[model samples]
Target chain A: MDPLEVEFLAEKETVKIIPNFSLDKIYLIGGDLGPFNPGLPVDVPVWLALNLKQRQKCRIVPPEWMEVEKLEEIPFSMGLTKLLLTHASDNIPKADEIRTLVKDIWDTRIAKLRLSADSFIREQEAHAKLDNLTLMEINTIRTFLLDSLNCMYKLRSNLQQGSSKGQFSNY
Target chain B: MSDALSDCGSDASHDGGQEDVMTPAELIEKLEEAWLNEKFSPELLSNRSEVVECVMEQLTHMEANLQRVKKGDAKASIHRMEIDRIRFVLSSYLRSRLQKIERFFPHVLEKEKSRGEGEPSLLSPEEFAFAKEYHANTETYLKAVALKRMPPNLQTVELLKAVPEPCLDSFVFLRVKEPQENILVEPETDDQREYVVDLEEGSQHLMRYRTISPLVSSGAVQLI
Candidate 1:
């Protein structure tokens, strides 16, 4: 999957936003969004929140996990951080600190991922428990890892057979 | 949109009406599941025409309602944005299926041909037509371009051998939705030992697609 597409899915994660203008409840296909009353907070998806924030119509209340001190304990999504920091940084307190902390966390997690993947390959393990790994992390290694695995399968299957033709299709 | 759901939603589920009474949110979720499954699976999966038609009906109804209201309304804008997002997913899901069909048309048609009479079809009627047309066009193109010049014995092409099948042995990341016991995990090579593992609900794993393909079809697990 494209990283942008992962970001698109991340945009669906709901966040709290305070709308400056009052409006009646709006029915949406996914679900109902807002009966926006001035100075009152309501839950809205990140996509709409960013749109409203960009238009100066709302202030986004950052999710609790985005804070610097609490960052280590909570599992953070890389796509969500990019979306929030790029568009709604002014509304979020300590945006720079959050960015640095999230990056550090990302680096540590990725280092662990690499080490595990190395062992997974070196050991020739056929199955792995992938709990707690986010879609973004899986996606980063997806193509290369899948291709190599497929190649290994093909190579192993070929050991018993004579010749295989036109196995890998053209991109 | 909610009011008009039962008015037309049931009509779309003519495949025995299994998903007859889904809410708009549930319908979107089903579509997303279908989308992700189609996106991750190595081969073409069973078509979710029921979900597709319902979403299409819902989008049309919502857009028709939008047309009646004046522009520049905040609610209207929000509704438009929501519609656009759903539409993006809907189109991307459909486009991925089409891409797979193009990549594996002959095998797709072969599967359709062999399907039992009362069983649910692998391809939707429109997709079936597309695969047939694609198969015929490719044969004609091959003959016209290169096959015609070859020796008569070598002219006939076996499409199954010509194109690669979807590699089911490829690894996939999935989250188990239902608990399964003693599912066999095949060895990578002859030297490695095979083992069985329990798939606990809500736990994620990486394994060969072939072992879990049935689970995927049954919606027992979701490919991430």
Candidate 2:
């Protein structure tokens, strides 16, 4: 239901993925899943895509030609993400709750970052401190913080509404 | 279209100019007329050259003012006219033309507004773009983690995006959980029996607190 489109690399078309959390499946927006590794190298990509759809009813479409350059080089966090997905499966309520909680928590963190940025900008305006930072730098920090918080807020709303297909947690 | 040109020419006469010294405004009108007529004329080229000079001078003036401001000397306030002029020159000409067209077609602007308002989360363009990007990157991060068999690390993640919300300084405290006292009282026994009551103690207080930041604005002001 959420209008966001998830783009990922796939073998044929650049698949637009949508997640169907209620059904525990991901419908390839324009296509479907292809052959991939079974181990940690490809689990998160598959599980994350599938679980996100199941929990949010959205899909994650791979971009074109998204091959694993090196199987051994995969990051550990992706595997951890898959583990969380596995643990939370079948308990849709818990999974959805955690997804919401993760996003809400991330939103709070972003708000804090924004507050820090605002303080920094105010100090710059008041004391005119550009000791180590350019005015643009300070402005950039402020912009980034605000942008992050706003983004998290959108995701939070989307998750709460159960229409966040193709949309990911802002965290 | 013929009538439109005559009207434009009459309007152009309001401004003071030499026989060929048309202002940028007149040049714009003439260019529009020419485009409508689908005729290429040598005069259009000359007119465009003059407009370019006016635009160049405007930008030079702004650059000088910015230099002064950057050096802590804010003597001159860059006026809006000069700013518009500079912008016209710097950005592609099509942008200005599109703006003019949009002005003529007011419904386009209204449609854009309606689309945004229709969304459940009324996020600004910048906010939506950043959020989408963050989601993508987060997925990328997850994929990276899975590939490497490494533990999830939040430190590498960059939370902020290029455009921040405007009202980011406001914050509110949220009570996540509240304490409640329970009293269990025993009621009457059956038929011909008497009634009795029992009471039990409950928690004095129990609650959890969370700081809620409003989604309406940035709500991220800091004191630095």
Candidate 3:
């Protein structure tokens, strides 16, 4: 069965959540989606059971505590991609193209982070330079990084999968 | 007064049923369920708030009756009296809550309407500040009040569009800033509209309104 589409309706905003296909119904209910309630904000700590349809499986990942990486050191490539895709700004004249380019840069950045430990260290040092900024502004910067990086990674992954078509490989 | 009450009990159900043993919270829960099922009658609200008092007293009476039964009073008449007492209490409370239930929807609707049309908001800036204050206060409050059940920022605001200049001369509104998210509106002589908006971004059903100002009436109850 296809994944059950879960829509979050809050105020006038609508957000559709897509969980990984392997997540189970029980896990979905017990995890973030089930624990999501209207009376409380998203950050509340509550144990709740979810009741997702049987088409998908779910798993619960505990909060990961890291000593080496402070909030500042964590990469923003994923969030940046989402923002570039969704957020529109009048100030950034070439926002779309710049976002695309930023995303490509991040893809290379992530590959460096994932494949070589030194790349991750270098990125952390770069982000640390923006320490004087407020948390919100820092988050925006990180989000920008995530958006570009993720897009590039996905493009690369797609190209690799489609490489079987010999004539189209160069393109 | 006690003798006058005993006669009312004699005329009601004579068996101690399952409802006789339920607590006040449980009874309200049952009434809530009844309201959902559309099984409630118009007579539900006829008794007013007395219904809640009566139900609470009835539950107390039944508990007393159970004690009597345990002490070796198994007489059929005694058991019947217990049942009758509970039934009357349940019916009375159910009716009262149900009666107010209708009033609740209208009151909320009226408040929303009045909020839309009523006075220019002098409270906008204060309200915004209060939201932030509430967030900070809630952070402290939640440490003591159990964060799992209570949110760190629970602010309710009554928002109205800026009033036009023509209406300002005749209207008077007072806005009092309180600690955290609480704002107190002074006793308003003219018509007043208050709306409670829940600012939690993740929640769907976050806004509600009521005409009877808790400050003017019985005071508002905060749920954490």
Candidate 4:
């Protein structure tokens, strides 16, 4: 993984911290940490926060997304769509609600991606008709279309299967 | 009802002999758990191929089972959807693995080359060949464009701009867990090696990665 991507993931994961003692600002190669003050809550990356919590230097506040109420409202919160799809937490209080919310979010994202992919593919096809589609453009569109179509098929199947399982279990 | 009960019975029985067979749902659940737990460490490189192959085999079985169900059956449709989901996850996992390998391709290749023996690569044969070709092309281009113009005395290239530098030499913020004494080796002097730094527990510092890599791996320190 790229260090940038690692940093991005860490940045996205917020953790609340309460420092135990006062400390001078510690400079790191990446950046400075803090002139940490005791008894004050501060938000930091999960990695840094977790380390502090482990050392008994700070108390950690979990991310808001992990809250059950927030998770339950996820399906309705179309504007709140910055959730990382890959960060699956096993110990969430409401597993079913979270699962459904994640599925809904995945479906929404995939739908948007498919829409863009379809237009791009169509444009590429039209360009190809005029022999104006460059090799790079063709390859890019091909991969995008393939991935979008694959995701679409998967989502469709999941939706169908979920409904069918409900009906089957009722019988 | 009997068929559903029979399927449940088979699933229950399979718990005792898990190596024999697994239901599609169980397989999917397993794959999802595995995907969730995957940390993309270097040690997991070999295991990833095996896991992918196992998932692919189960998917093939699931596909066959799906086909056997009557057309328009809801259960069958669900199975079809599950298969697609599994495929998507598998593909994404493979792609991420590929990206990691590609990012570290030059470093991996050099390590393998220095061993003086051909070893298995995390990438497929085609990808490996492509990386080799790409590196070769980049080196030739760099030589032609920049290196060739430089005076012969100053043309000594320390490292290729195209290849990624080793991350082990980079400084990182590390939190120490266990106290230990470490000898600090100054790069400039071979004679002045009396400097000893004491690593204190619960303290964090930005230090050379090589100085802390062993401690990190041994759980004596953690990278922040």
Best by DockQ: 1
Cα deviation of B22 in candidate 1 (Å)? 0.7
Please give me the total number of clashing residue pairs in predicted model 4: 2
Ranked by TM-score, the better of candidates 2 and 4 is 4
| Tens-digit per-residue lDDT, A11-52, candidate 2 | 112223443322222222111233232221122233344534
Better of 1 and 2 by DockQ: 1
Q: What tens-digit string does per-residue lDDT give for candidate 3 at B64-131?
A: 65665545432323334434534543564454443333333233223334654543321224333443
Docking class of 2: incorrect
Say which candidate scores most in TM-score. 1
TM-score, model 2 to reference: 0.18
What value does the lDDT take at residue B146 in candidate 3?
62
User: Residue B177: error of model 1 in Å?
Assistant: 1.5
Instruction: Give the per-residue lDDT digits (tens) of candidate 1, residues B1-113.
Output: 66547745675456443776668887798799889999998889999888888898889989999999898977888888888999999999989989999998888888888
Ranking by TM-score: 1, 4, 2, 3
Residue lDDT tens for model 4, A1-171: 233333433332455667787766643212235667888776654556544555566765445665556755543322112222223233235556666765665565556545655674443221111122222222234334444433443354466566311100000
Tens-place lDDT digits, model 2, residues B138-219? 5577567663465446324332322221221221111112221221211111222332222112211110001112110121
For candidate 4, lDDT tens digit of each residue in B8-52?
Answer: 334333322334444444444444433432332222232234345
All candidates' chain B TM-scores are 0.93, 0.21, 0.24, 0.48
DockQ of candidate 3 is 0.01
Binned by DockQ into CAPRI classes (incorrect, acceptable, medium, high), candidate 3 is incorrect
